[model samples]
Target: MDNASAITVFTLSGLNGTEKYRIPLFVVTFLCYSLIWVANVIIIVTIIMDKNLHEPMYILLCNLCISGLFGTAGFYPKFLSDLLSSTHVISFPGCLLQGFVVHAYIGVDFSILLIMSLDRYVAICRPLVYHSVMTRQRVGLLVLYAWLLPATLVMVGSITTFILKLCDSHIPRLYCINYFVNKLACTASVANFIIPACTYTIYVCHFVIIFWSYFYLIRTCRQSKEKMSKFMQTCLPHLFCLKILGVSLLFDLMYIRFGSVDLPQGLQNFIAIEFLVVPPILNPVIYGMKLTQVRNRIAQLFGKRDPMPHKAEFLMVEFESSCPNPPQDPFEGTQHRHEGVSLNQDIIQAFSAAACLASGSRHGLIRLGGASSGSHTLFRHGEAVFKLKQQVSELLLF
Candidate 1:
């Protein structure tokens, strides 16, 4: 209590007694941080630049990567610098800010993953209404909720922690946490305990809601093989991401309460920073490798394309146009009419093209294609087809 007024900086004793390994640790940390930035930046930029990827699902993923970047930025820079220096100290405000960013990042991860699962549910269980329900405005709003809710909770919690009058200036971990900071309080209050409990309870409810939604998602997928493939393609990555987050955060929480000095220092350090290191790197990689559209786009960027068969290509073999005066030739555009239904000329242009980006209908991707391209013109809306060939090498559809 007597030292409460004199402290301006806190010592991070996590780096204690590891002086000899500092350079090696710094190198590894730097590379890890660089990989985090590269992986995340690739995802963010790829989603933003590719118009084919502008769907609700991809948009949500972009935000996920953004949040990954947000959270890791708070830890890695400081940790890297600390690894190289004999004295690992942080100013009062810096400690709080780091805590705020890291915690908010965790909050955002929980909210976004839940939002993503709901998105998967709607897409798998209610394909027809997916677009209508996940409208641009609604998606924007959902994303807003994902970000604002956690940020608000974390800010309030940070404020609560900030008001504490601490008697000690040493944090044993590599970073600051409101929980530990509160432990240094000259005195304790009911609000401190109440607020943290409430915050954690809310996040727990988020997990509950997500699991329930996935319960239904799994059930609906079992009804058909197509549905099952969709579930495996899209939902698996989300589950993996959720698992990464759960395990890392859970270990850290357990360590906070039950950590024993008998544990190896390396093990303790890993537990404390697992969330900071693992999730940021794996989230982007998992989504990239799992999702069809994202994976194809990334491959395309690197001048490689994966072969995928498309269902839409078979339907495009022949289309009847009710143009007032339709061209008899499929290759050359003309006006014709049949059954009083008119097909737009754009269909001919779209069907005639061969190399398409393959993110065709907002409704869904093309899933079936082994039938060769035939001499028929169809009014495909969003696909580009220059099909004068007897066979399509392969149609890539997201």
Candidate 2:
């Protein structure tokens, strides 16, 4: 089918004729839709307020929440309108617009997920370089690409679908997605099937690469005990999210290529909620609860701080006549040590003695060791008591 014969509008056969089902369906759909929206909103607000969540993982999560909002917003309003109003009709342009926005956001969401996986891979795989590689500036640029690239792709796909002529007017689902909506068109090109298939394949390949990167990251982290525990804590939530998204995609693939099995649809629809909603909801919880920095911020936000233990302090009293050159066994020697002092004790005695010795004044040159080879001289300004300690120490030796 060429561009001229393509059908612009599609008539949805989903609960359109039922008078009794409309109000109940509206309430149920409205609640589900509202739940997704409210949950996403909470995540976005939490990320913005929590200083601990300023990192790339949390930023990616915020983006995903925004994308999910766009997805739900694009699909539900029109769905609500169709359900409530006497007219179940959508103009060709309106239907096309809806399709574009929905697919575009889905694409953007996928790209953001890829970026998140890469963020985790770098954090675990290259710990030293992770900050340099995924800095704020670099993250901002990646996010721009995540949104923009999908928008371009959406334009191409939406145009292709809009231009194809429809043989029948009835669209099967409550929502107009790519496959079912496209099936209504009269022009079924290998291009139509091939292009979408290739697009999905590209996304699938992206998903595969992220998992492969994470696999290597996990393997590398296991070699070191310190990093191993932190690595598991950091990567677990992302792994769960990836699993949910994988199942959603799997069902989508099967639904499109194979015959529409009842099992796949049920699983797909259920997993779809997880794919879009769970990541956003879990992101703040995981990052906020597990990380020290985030927890500190949370405390700070609540105007609280952890109590610090008091430390006991004392003075050092013993000293040696001859100061050793190498300071023998600093930790073990007790000759110049305050044996009973706790580690936190301040070295007050030495400072006090030095202060007292430097307080008075004098001015003279004094020699020690009786001018022998080892003799040392001390200069006192008519009253530079700072040199008194040296003179007194030399006299003590003599």
Q: Top model by TM-score, which number?
A: 1
Candidate 1 error regions (>4 Å): 307-317, 321-398
Q: For model 1, what is the error of residue 337's alpha carbon versus the real structure, in angstroms, after optimal superposition?
A: 15
For residues 1-398, could you state the per-residue lDDT of candidate 1 as single tens digits? 45786777999888887888999999999999999999999899889998757778889899999999999989998998888777899998898899999999999999999999998888777664566788899999999999999888889888887777888998988899888888888999688888889888999999999999999999998998867886898899999999999999999999999889788887889999999999999999999988766777788788987665223223233332322322343422223222211122323333333222122322211122223333343323345232322122212212
Error at 306, model 1, angstroms? 3.8
Candidates' C-alpha lDDT:
0.75, 0.60
Candidate 2 Cα deviation (angstroms), residue 202: 1.7
Query: Residue 198 lDDT in model 1?
Result: 88
TM-score of 2: 0.66
User: What would the TM-scores of all predictions be?
Assistant: 0.81, 0.66
lDDT of 2 by residue, 238-320 (tens): 66656665676565556556745354443444443443444444545564566444455556556876442111111223322
> Model 1 has how many clashing residue pairs?
19
Q: Count the backbone clashes (under 3 Å) in each candidate.
A: 19, 11
Q: Could you give the C-alpha RMSD of every candidate to the true structure, in order shown?
A: 7.9, 15.8
- Cα lDDT over the full model 2: 0.60
